[model samples]
Target: MVALHRFVVLTTTLLLTSLAWGETSNPYLPRARLLLEELRYAEAARALDQARAQPGNARDTLLEILELQGVVAGMLQQPAKARTAFQTLLVLAPDYRLKGDYAPRVVTPFFEAKGWVGDKGAALRLEALPTSGADNLLTVQVKPDVLNLGRSVRFHQREAGAGWSEQEQPLTEGKASVARKATRVEWWAELLDERRAVLTSLGSDTSPLGALAPGAISATPAPLPAPAPVSPLPGKQPQVARAPGLPLRTVAYVSLGLAVGAGATGGFLGVRSNQDRARVVGAPVDEAGLTVGLTQREAFALDARARSQARWANILFGVAGAAAIAGGTLWVLGAPVNVSATPAGVVVGGAFP
Candidate 1:
């Protein structure tokens, strides 16, 4: 009897230890977390694995098996396994934001994700944009994959060696044609600034640029030429820069000079006023006539300086206003002004906004 009791006790103890080792959450979880916080991922993962293996462990949503598995797998540099673990984690914890972790992977060659607009659990794929004109006819290709794009594009041709996005691929003899495919219709073409439109369910595809709409952008998949770079961003240049139609477009140079001189006038007024006050205060009352005369002269000088600054400001605005009207007139006559600003000052030499 004694022998049997001892044997039973030994077996029970061993079984308990094994069960503890396999439990989902060890009491030392906090300590393991501390280790993880200190960048001790390996040790923390080992601790977590032991905790998870404890037999007859209570189901703890806060410490799910998948959660522990993901952390362990991530620490092991097994990204594929880690993602599997995380997907399982999502099945258990649906409210969490795993999209941040998976967004980059979604658009890769290996990730074959899909969604459907009409059927439940169905997924859509990438689709190519349609083309009809000579500009896009040969350059555009239909992709077998349907990419749900609400992006719109306008039809425009960029001259070769300038900035055309849709380009001619080198064919047999000197003739080149734009290359395209089902997976990716890789071409770039100049967009009509006025025609560029976005296609969407809201149906905003009616832009003046033309029929091409967008959800995804069609690219050359190559660098555009540096000689004719893309247009600079709108509002990049100052308003004064775009105006070049006045009699005094040349006088923008004067406006810049005027602003600087106005600040100088303020400095001069301050300096002269202080010096004159001292001179009058130090002199005798017997020289009241001279003092008064000197004070009058100083006041007139200050007034003249202020007036000169104001007049310059007026001239600057007046000239700019005239330029705007004249530039518009020239633009209507098919001669546009491309006013440009330079570090030296405003330079009006473009063909215009």
Candidate 2:
């Protein structure tokens, strides 16, 4: 029973540690499905991806899976697969659209235009170079905004390219890729019109300032972004270097353990000494009356003195042991044993032998 309980505890502790590292991938199904119903198809698909990770977590009937899959396929513009997936979803979740709010009808193609900048997912903002004009090649500047990367010119006009959607300008897209890797991308907007275009740049971090030219077509970028600050988690104390050796904590705990051992030893010795003295076998110094021969009263007095001295020694050992153990534990736990300022944060970590 004891061992079984210990096993359970160990498993739970490991599970908790994993959770701390990342959220467990379950319970995302319903939410993902709801997102799909609400037309948040992309996000829903991503959610379902996470949910599908756990083994045997696919409790949904195969038909239900097919249904959601179909919706996702359609939303992603995979018509062939969409047809198949919808067939499944319809069979399994017949009243999905009925149960939840859904769009009344389809509109013009949503994928009419598309672009990405920076990372794959970062959308490039587009605008018809109204200010620049079709006769003009709008020059977009790229800057390295990453911390410590510097404020130097990473790229400039002609660094980024303009073109139609891949479907329309596959050749241009191919050409644009030639130099993309060299620059820090800021935005990617459509140059469809001489005045207005779509932007796929700066991502969520950037301001959604449309083309400098007016008669803009977009609603305010769906959501304005919050200001960018330095590191997010704050007040996390800096760490420091320690004297070369085991972590101070390690030294501390080991010392404490030794001290505890010493304390125990000392206490045992003290009691033994007292017992010996009482028996007169190893009484401390003879008492005052015992000049020539020792008397029982003198022996007893000497024993008591010895015992008192031993007691003090044991108490000292106990205190030292405690300090060592405490110090060692802290070091092992990775707490800064010798925290001090470096600049923004103290640097810890060094070779240990």
Candidate 3:
């Protein structure tokens, strides 16, 4: 009778354990779906977390968790978190697109993130122009803007021996140039996230650096020789030879670029400020009709922000103008001054008498 009792107890324990496992092993999809319907966003997020915590969840199941997490975070106004979640999704499937059922606001940020890291996107045309007087020099122009601020544009040249020369520069104001003896040169760009990890790379267009003009024929010309020094005149004070200061020109160009950038920013801010003014005029209403999901206080705050931005833009424009004027003055007056290197460092003096 004791042995019989022991066998029955053991069987009951095994049955209970089996039932528990059966209930827990099932996926969490149903739970999450129910939570979403109730508009319990936080709870739904927690449900997805629970699903991820479980061992042996299928790949598809995990993917769905990420997707839902992004959607929830976006709805909650957590853009950074949503961006991170979508980034993971893109890593898994580069071409992944969110379902159409999701709202436009939620889906928009996802694609923008994808485009920043994805292979398919608009590419800028890079042209290599040979400067008028300099043969070994190639000026690279990436017109307009650098496309992405966080990206780096690298310039490379193929050596006569075997490999490429390691010389590169970041794309500043969408322009760069390289001087080298190599007959062949090319350029490529890379995109990196804040963590400094390379997210994507754009292949070099293979347009040779020696091409004189856009769509012109490619050619390999000999390296230009250095100009011979001019002889000093006899009897008079030996005049110091001077080349036009390039720093002045760079400052001028950079100032001009800044002016353009600042002007564009100011124009945008002015338009936005006007928009806010219009919104203020039509409180709770837009040109189309009644504006939904917005309040008067919110509109006022936006208008304030727009005003502040416009002010900042104007300040930057002022700085740009001043810098341009200063730079222009310097460039025009950048005739080389006299410098005599002595045993004690160096000394600057007025132009040769």
Candidate 4:
């Protein structure tokens, strides 16, 4: 029984990890492409929707989704949607052009959308400017000034890997501040019309502008001073002194290993509890309509065990998640780390020797 449970735990962990990786790898994009090739535009559109909904899609994946959405909308005679899609694509890639041969119906709307953006001039263009004489404060400016349009600018800001928060200000002011405590900030600005409809956006949720807080620097540990060379007595060798304290990287690895073990144990218990529940529910009934495979007392006992195991499984899962987060944080903050600032966000790299 113990061996079987261990096997189930390992199998469950692998299955869950693979499923998560599959989602991140995007199974819908190729399916959508196939559907599009088959001229099943509606099905293709649905697949594109699924692709858009899936998190962690890369920039190329987003561009493809917009491209397909525009084409699918045009094929379905949804000119407004097609125009909107094309316009968004154009905003992301100003010089983007239709690559493949397309019908006039599909081609016309795209050019019209291009013309619309061209006429807007700098109305859609936004810039984030550091506030003068203010720490951690940023002011947004719209080219050609959008205050006359009676629109509002909404700023979305967050620390890396954190949930976004919105701050809406009149287009006239364009005042928003970054969190002073944040080491790295990701932000985007959206122009909203009177009805809160987004007319144009500076950055998107998937792609945001990243900025490091002023005076915030990556913590790099200083090298330790070498110990004085001890003069060895005749025929005696001096031993090298070991560094004190446990390595942060080793602690991180241990935490991660514990997290995986706990998660697997939880998954196995959950599966076992579900099986027990199924047995209790599907037990054979005798001619008297009473459960025969499991006695009434046995059914009650099994139900209680299932519930108890489920509760413990949930607790273990929670612990696993917390441990995983702690491990990842430690890994990122460990010494000998390299922090690279990119337009999208800050990337931290480290390794144990």
Best by TM-score: 4
Writing each residue's lDDT as its tens digit, candidate 2 over 169-286 gives 2113212111222222333322221111111232222332223222334545777788896653465554555564446656666676777777777777777665655445422333
Model 3 clashing residue pairs (backbone): none
lDDT of 1 by residue, 1-353 (tens): 99999889766754564354344234655445445545686887776665554533332423244455565555555546655555533432332332222212211101111101111222211122455443434222212112222122222233323333432222122112333322232233321111121111111123212233233365547677689666546557644433434534445445545545555655565565445434433333333222222343443344345445445545655655565555445444333355555545566554432
Please tell me which model should have the higher lDDT, number 2 or number 4: 4
Query: Which residue segments of model 4 deviate by more than 4 Å?
Result: 1-24, 122-126, 138-176, 179-353
lDDT tens digits by residue: candidate 4, 1-353: 99999889766765564453333367787777667777999999999898877754554556667878998998787878988888877665555766556654466566556545555652346677863443776567765542333267778888867898888777665443434436577888776555454445678889988766666665666789999977545554333332322476678898899899999999999998888766765666556443355554565567668767887899999999998998887776555645554545556555534
Name the lDDT value of residue 125 in candidate 3: 46
RMSD of 2: 31.6
Candidate 3: misplaced stretches above 4 Å?
1-105, 108-131, 142-151, 186-202, 205-353
Name the 10 consecutive residues with the lowest summed lDDT in model 2. 106-115
TM for every model, in the order presented, reads 0.21, 0.21, 0.29, 0.37
Computed on alpha carbons, the lDDT of every model, listed in order, comes to 0.39, 0.40, 0.56, 0.68
lDDT of 3 at 283: 43
Candidates, ranked, TM-score: 4, 3, 1, 2
Report residue 23 deviation for candidate 2 (angstroms). Answer: 89
How many Å off is the CA of 101 in candidate 1?
10
